[model samples]
Target chain A: MIENVTLDISGERFQVFYRLRCEAQDVEAFARHICVEQTIEFPAELIGDDDIRRHVMGQVVSLAPLDDHSWRVVISYAVEITGFSLTQTMNVIFGNVSLMPGVRVDRLEFPDSFLSRFKGPRFGLQGLRDLVGEKHQQLYCSALKPMGLSADQLAQQAYQLALGEFHFIKDDHGLADQPFAPFRERVSRCVEQVAKANQQTGGSSRYVVSLNSPAEQIVEDAIWAKEQGVGGLLVPPGIVGFDMMRRLADDDRIGLPILCHPSHLGSYVASPDNGLSFYALFGQLARLAGADVSIYPNFGGRFSFTRDQCLEIVKGCTDPMAILKPIVASPGGGMNFSNVQDMVDAYGKDIMFLIGGALHKGDATVPENCRAFKAQVAALLRR
Target chain B: MIENVTLDISGERFQVFYRLRCEAQDVEAFARHICVEQTIEFPAELIGDDDIRRHVMGQVVSLAPLDDHSWRVVISYAVEITGFSLTQTMNVIFGNVSLMPGVRVDRLEFPDSFLSRFKGPRFGLQGLRDLVGEKHQQLYCSALKPMGLSADQLAQQAYQLALGEFHFIKDDHGLADQPFAPFRERVSRCVEQVAKANQQTGGSSRYVVSLNSPAEQIVEDAIWAKEQGVGGLLVPPGIVGFDMMRRLADDDRIGLPILCHPSHLGSYVASPDNGLSFYALFGQLARLAGADVSIYPNFGGRFSFTRDQCLEIVKGCTDPMAILKPIVASPGGGMNFSNVQDMVDAYGKDIMFLIGGALHKGDATVPENCRAFKAQVAALLRR
Candidate 1:
């Protein structure tokens, strides 16, 4: 009976390896609980019903004790159970079991058929490179910040950032449809200003406006950004569900590149032993959700992300997959001129250098600061 | 310059306290970084611009050392910044800074005007009691689980649970639209059986179906469930989103009481110092998102939630707010019939005791097991 559910690697079954930390006596119960919690939530007697068990039951591939307190529980589920639906797939992965503590989703291995169901990335690393017309060098990105500026003033900053030759200018994550600077007005003005600056400077800089709105209005805003010819759209998938990003990428009506922001998502990666790995969260999940660029905090910044964590995020973005195109791992948060070369040395040419306040420091004008920031990247790449 | 942006409690200013763990030298910079990261993204020179600083800047309230490595940093922003949108409110609370590690949201205090902008809960504790036609006892709830069962089998279980005079019968959180028991068919069948059993037993048992679907289809499913005349709906806001729950609670067309499931939400409360408090995640946030019954893992259960944490969640559910009504704090994970009295003693009459496997255990039939569970609760309350 136990041999009946033997996992066929070529078959349409998704394997999810969960690191379940529990006592030895509790290990068996924990493993069984996860099987029931992740798949069927009924009596074990039902598993005796062969038809029912095969359809809805999850089989524990193997369970071994990692330590006295923790056990590595590997479980596999039939892909048909997920219905090839992204939301359902997520539900299948961490639905009820995510409620239980010490059960971390260590790794997720999807069958080719399962991965094929998702439209990975509309514009990935190379596509983004082609869109910006920067094929060889690392990309440059900046943020339009300080929430109270009127649409005109914010546009002026966007124009300045573009003039400095930054490839992408994003709205700070905090910029929503506030009373001071409304969404439509700010996005329109900034988009226009970025266009004008690109025309003047002969550059292909993009203004990626924030489209973090209510679910009903999010699509409308995305379409508006496309109509206004925004370079890209920044979506905080953590606030808006990840599936929303997939929908955006799949919708041909608004087929613009997406920059996934990591807002309200720190808890998942804060604890190393629980939740998701940095590579999985920022890299794999972002790419799966159709992010052209996954933005995270860079190391040696005010943030707590270390160099190793940042490297994992990079691997998750660029690692080979079935058909999912690689995406850029854009790291920001406290980046400056002083460490741009170090960042370049660490990430090489595949990454995007996201500098914020460091570009504006010292006595140079905004455009001069931008030029200098661009020059720093160019010099490092040339070397 | 600081006086220009005075903290006006009457003028809709929301205060957020963050526990920033950092070295002594980094505290001031961390405080300033959060202010800029939250509001204005431009340089400090831009803050010097009276117009920009007056409207868009967040003011640092106070900073005090918590320990050798942590500091309590209080920051306030003008309510106008959030636009009173739940999505935006969450962004304002923990947006770009969520990428930063060790900055945990300790507390959130909102002005009445700000809190009044969004609808809280449709049915609180009293309303739910009124809905279920129960007046003077702690309510009892069970799950129709072990996912491999067919729709007819699940309906039979629902029928048996209702016949036993249980107050509520909910689909286990794992029951999505699987082929074994599709959403529409399973929900329809379960609803019919519960209604049939209620009529046969002269009872008012409600079957709360799980409506966790893709974003586009979730609303459609909710409407379908409502059209079928289901008692209540269980939504995993963590999988969907907390704001999406708010949207559902606000929509009049799908005006059904929501049972917010804590699936994929453990990471937020798993760590003591890093993420959200249990009360914040399960209680206050759940109530704010319109969860009529906020379900969490009970203390001394198979799950890791502590007794103190469970008590805090109860307070979060029933504690006084401006207009947000008190809701039922439903505790479930690892709960059994044997510990029903202990649960009652711990949580009292205002709580909803959610027992699952224990209800189906012993020599009794499924219906007989349910009756024994009801008897135990009755015995405890009658004492």
Candidate 2:
């Protein structure tokens, strides 16, 4: 599958853009330190092998001062060292250096060799749109909430939401295999109920179950969810490994679109000067890992993502990568019906507006609330 | 079997100690917000069901002002909500609330019902000490380095390190299935060579391979590594899910002491007011997820762990948790031979000195350097 791998000393390399928030004098040194620390982690003088020194060692290609207090540096690592796996690529990019402070990964650029390695997002924006067979420009999604609800109660909730004709109805990230409503029981009941509602309304509503478990069990659960005629899967890539999600995305047997949730991953994007950018973590990496849809906290939400950061997240998701499909960005932390127009106005049509709690704040019943949400979204798209 | 689970209005609950870094006036309100956001995530007025509100909702047990600008809050959730799973436990504790800016998880306390769910560590401190069969107070571990080395070259290095009689020699976390040294070839060769060296020296030197891959492959690789006569496993719980490592530690067939490396988990501990404390993230959570030894950056290391923070991490690893055995703390990240005495004096006997690059920096050959390291440790411990 890897057609053209540059094996020479100047072999094609994947580039990582890092924003070093340090003293002006220490910028180059900081960039050089990342180069050394990322690869060999040993004194360059000690590395006798020239091949490893030149190829395996991370190469710093560009360094520019961002301002008085910060510098932007671009570092490159050999394509061969990544071994064409998401885990290794992440290791080469972040790995031990993630422990360091005042460094933020801005973005990443991969060569053809590295890009060809992953089958990112099996059902991205177009595929998902095709699946839905909907004419609306903006798709809407709602989450089933209150974790202690029994299978029947949650399924009934799902039926009400699906009847609203939202493109996707997903389980809350917290809804795992709990004793109150076990995974199999909850997933099957929700799938069946959603399907029955869809059949009645002649709408193609898909129910997504959260697959947050150990690796082996997640795969098993994914297969089971697919067998139950479930349309999609919600996986927190931070909880389960990204590559694990990639495996699920690439697996044809259970080829459901994966929706990535920001669970334990907030820390990575929270620190502006310490960790990775929201664009890189949520958008690029999620797509590379085969997530058809990625979710993050929207602006004016309970969470602390600014409008600019949220917009950047949308850019990362729908931006053109080499051959990878642009994934749909679903922004929902404290989303409500009142802000629905504002969200769509900012993110435009390709996005999925995930309105969770606001659906409950409606004056009408739950199913009636769904119909009202449909009218608002349809009206917004027409505008 | 769950012995006694209180199932009333005031039932047994697992406690999450959080530090809210906000204004004094917003202390209780902030704590209350976490209680609401962590569970249900919906407004109380919207939830008509009394049972769901009373039983499943997160309870704010204690709230106190820590300083003029911060507050200490202890929130508890029903044991039934956790569903006796690490994935869900993490979700309930952090989950959606992880996106909050001013909150930090200070510590955690589990009830009997929650504690009984996990079989902590199969091989804790004593179990690992038995495996080594050495009389040394502080165990020594070294990492095989400089990526892009062939499997034969790495195996030779492993053999040399084993001949040095270090307690354990581990593959660097970056060493995945690269073309230079495929995982199987590197693991099998290193295991064989280390065993041969141990046979010659009459030492019980263990070769720990880094299993940083997808879930299914990691388990399969672990079983195969065990069959190849590997003595231990090194897992990055951050890259691979924490529960995945727990599954390996609990698996009886491939029973080996698990060493946890902090790879992509730095941001969680880096920010003072945004994410989790070093103690809670590295110490308590790692042990709860079944790590026999947890590795983090030392105080004076290349990384930015303060001396106090490092000590807290140690306490977290070895402190008493219900029925869970105390795991050894392996403090690494730019550790050298010069700091061995200081490290031991600070950490006492129940620690492992993971000296990697320093082993190569010695005047003598690596094998001679190993013996010198042994003499230094033995002499220091006798004092």
- Number of colliding residue pairs in each model: 11, 1
> Total clashes, candidate 2?
1
Question: Could you tell me which 10 consecutive residues in candidate 1 chain B have the lowest summed lDDT?
Answer: B1-10
Q: Mind sharing the TM-score for model 2?
A: 0.96
- State which candidate has the highest TM-score: 2
**lDDT tens string, model 2, B138-240?**
7889988877778888888899999999889999888888888889999989999998999999999999998886654888989989998998999988888
Question: Highest DockQ: which candidate?
Answer: 1
Report the Cα lDDT for residue B72, model 2: 83
Residue pairs with colliding backbones in model 2 are A121-A290
Candidate 1 — what's its lDDT?
Answer: 0.81
Query: Lowest summed lDDT over 10 consecutive residues: which window, candidate 2 chain B?
Result: B1-10
lDDT of 1 by residue, B1-383 (tens): 11122222234477888888889999998888787777766566634646446545677889999999999998888788886788887887777676666777767777777778868999899988998888978887899877656788789889989998888899988788876678899999999999999899999999999877877688888888989978888988877888888888888998888899988788787666677777777888888888999999898886778888899999889887678989999998878866776788888889888888777766787778877776777788788
Scanning candidate 1 chain A in windows of ten residues, the lowest lDDT window is A1-10
Docking class of 2: medium
